[model samples]
Every structure is written in C-alpha cells, then in structure tokens.
Target: MINDKSFIHYLKEAEQDFSGWDFSYVTDTGRMAASLLSWSYGSMAKKLITEATSLLDMGTGGGELLAKLQPFPHSVFATEGYKPNFPISKKRLHPLGVTVVEVDEDNLLPFTNGQFDLIINKHEAYSAQEVRRVISENGIFLTQQVGGADCAEINEALGIPLNQEYLHWQLDFAKKELEDNGFRVVFAKEETPVQRFYDVGALVYYLKAIPWQIPDFEMGDYMEQLYGIHRKIESKGYFDVTQERFIIKAEPI
Candidate 1:
C-alpha cells in the first residue's frame, strides 16, 4: 500500500516542472499521443475484462489508463517502479478509486502468482522474466514499447542519430525469451508511425523524459538545439515527427 496523501507532494513537483512547458501549438498532437497510448491499453485489456474480474497495470504512468478503465468492474491495481512517477501517478488516479503502489524493479512483485487474470505493462520498464513470474497461468501480458526507431525526427531535426538498435533486439530476442519462459505469443507488430505535435517545446519535454537523454545529453545542449528548432516550428506551424513503436501481446503458459 502507498500513502496517497504523501504522494500529492510529488505530483505538485511534477506539475510545477511541467508548468514551465509551452504547449500552445502542440495541444492536438499531445492529445493524439494520449489517445493512441490509451487506445493500446483498451485494445489489450478489453477481452480480458469481459472474462476476468481483476487486473494489474505495471508502470501505470499518471494512472491515465487506470482512470480510463474506472467504469469497468475489474479490480485494478497498479505499480510504478520510479519513485517520483509513483506519487504523481497515484495522485492522478486515486480520486477515481485506483490504488497504485511503489514496487522494486528488480525484485518479485508484491502479488503472488496467478493473482491476476490480466497483467499489463504499458510503456513500463522491461524485466521479461519478472513478467513471467508474476502473471497467472494463461493471463495476458500486454505492452506497447518505445520502438527501435522512436523519435527519429528529433534526431533528424537536431542533425544527430539516436540509438535505435535496441528496438531491433526487442523483436528478435525478446520474443524468444517470452517463448522459452513458457508464454504463448498472441499479437506482435511494429507500429512505425509518427505522432504529430504542434509545439516544439512539448516535443522537447517528451524527449527530455527519455532516460538516455538525461544521462548522455547535456540539458544545456538540448535546450540550445530545441531553441534552434523552434524557428522551424514557427515557420511550419507544426512538425509531424514520426516515431516508431511496438505493440506486443502475450499470455503465460
């Protein structure tokens, strides 16, 4: 269990950080991204909810999907590994009767095996084996991952190449890992489509959210590049940057 009140403080921090952002031009694009992500969630769990009474959403960012599913009868429990994200996500969904817990990324999940009829990890950290461990037999494992060529436009706009090789590995090796672990694959496909946005600043914010972007790229450099890109954004009115993403669905054996 998490202290929902204490979590409010973290949400405040995130809101403050996000407040400085300029989202004027890209509101539509932002909404599209949210809609697409949320749609992926609905696609994964729709069938399960018709059959089962419980679900677990791993890395339920800002509890967006959980809030969307509130009207459904399933008992939804969520876990977020990042401490900062946990509190903010809790605040977002708690009012809607969603309960989110903090979980250690490397350890066993708090719930026992076969506890949930549906287990989902949308844009969550990867611990393929851990996923195998916690899910109930025949339970669904749904995911939408950062695709191999995600955010290629940012790289192009800034005249730099970001590592997209991992996406290649995700398809090649990750699938085999799941199969060897006794899970049967259901749906797997590459969705290499660009999510359009109007505001260059909002695009910058999403780029900053990436983990590798935090460690390797200097914030000053990124801001400088973003500032330079803003001129183009102003000229064109909006940029339709294509990002590659993968959608995977599986069930435990």
Candidate 2:
C-alpha cells in the first residue's frame, strides 16, 4: 500500500520546496541526475554577447539562466509568460539593467521588428515568424527546445498517453518551420539524454513542478502507479527516463 510507513517517509522527502526555475533541491542533492548534452547554450551565448549590441531572452524563467549568461549587451531584455515568475525575474534582473517584459502569447512579441541582434530561448515555446520578425537581418536566433518525446517514459510508466500535439516537435519540424519563416538554420542537433530519479517522490515533485508533464496530476489519482514505481525504484536503485532535447541556431535569410 502507498500509505505504508516507508512510502509516506519518502513522500515527505519529495515534498521539499523549490522555486524560480531552480531544481537544485533534487539535482544538487543527488536525488536526481541528468546526462549532459553535447553543446552548451551558455557558452555559445557568452561568445555571441560580446559582438551583440541588443539581446532578447525569451521565457526567462525567474531570470536565473539569463543572470548566469550575463555581462549583457547595451540593450538587454527578457520575457516571461508565467505570472508567478514576473516579480521574481524583475527583482533578480532589474539591477542588472535588463528590461523584463510580461508576454501573453509566443507569436506576439511587444518589441518592434528588427529590434534585436541576438535572441536566445531555452526550453521555451516560440513562434518562428515572431522570432524572424524581431531579429535584425544580421542577428542570430539560438534556442534549445524540449522535444515532444521529452520524459515520455514517465507517462508510459504511469499508463498515460503522450501529448499528441507535441509528439512531432523535434529538430526536423523546428528546422523546417524556421526555414519556411525566412530563417536559415546554421546549426542543429538533437539528443536523447538519460535522467534518473532515485525515489518516487522526486518524480512526483518534478511532475508537480512541470504541470504539462502530467496535466491534472493529483497524488490521489496516481497513488497506485506511484507505489508501483516506488517499489521498482527500491528494487532497481533508480527509475530512468530518456528525455528528448534539441538545439537550433539560425539567422534571417
């Protein structure tokens, strides 16, 4: 039974609080581990910033990743759609001279056309046309996206179907979308990396944090599946899942 003493004990451990696009509670503590990717977006961004006079960071969650990728260009901006992250990003980025904007739709950017020389997005949804419209002719658009198959193993283990709408979102689809929208892809790569969770609670906490992972996720509804996974983890040491990831670097055609 999931209500057993041991199950409850680990569930309590998984309830540890986290905030601001940060997952250090699990990641830093060794409760969860993800394999590394071949490329580093931060390193690439750092190099590009030196030559860029204007920059935009799309969906800058809590401004944490943006903050890390700084010494920014003269005109730097970040957009976040999530309301709870607005104040958090503002507090962290304002002092750094970034203009944090609240955006409602991925297709409707508030900035004027040809406004930015460098635009970067990490694990964020974006519209190809909107991005092409905003970037200068000589500008660069670099993004790392989570593929439709991201963490599908979790859904499979829980007997849930993968989200159909995003099932075809991968490097090929994104590259074609950009090309059709007047951008030439300069670099693109995709990889499936392994992510291992040491306990069931870590997975619960993760799914809770990322609602889209299991929309309408309720602990009560998933108790049996959770217990099954818990038992598996206890027997196997960890539950492993392959996550889909891809990166694209493009320029206006």
Question: After superposition on all CA atoms, how large is the RMSD of candidate 2?
Answer: 1.0
* Model 1 global lDDT (CA atoms, 0 to 1): 0.63
**What lDDT score goes with residue 12 in model 1?**
31
For residues 2-83, write the lDDT of model 2, one tens digit per residue.
4577777877777766566988888888989999999998898889887899999999989998998878889999999998
**lDDT score of residue 241 within candidate 1:** 67
lDDT of each: 0.63, 0.92
Tens digit of per-residue lDDT, candidate 1, span 1-253? 2334423332232232432123333354452242243246575566666666667888886675666664644477888877767777888867766678888854577877677777777666667777777777867888777665666677777667767546464555667878887788888876556566555545655555555533354334554465556556567866676665666788887
TM-score: model 2 vs. ground truth? 0.97
Q: Whole-model lDDT, candidate 2?
A: 0.92
Off by over 4 Å in 1: 1-16, 19-39, 72-74, 95-97, 159-169, 211-219
Q: Best by TM-score, which number?
A: 2
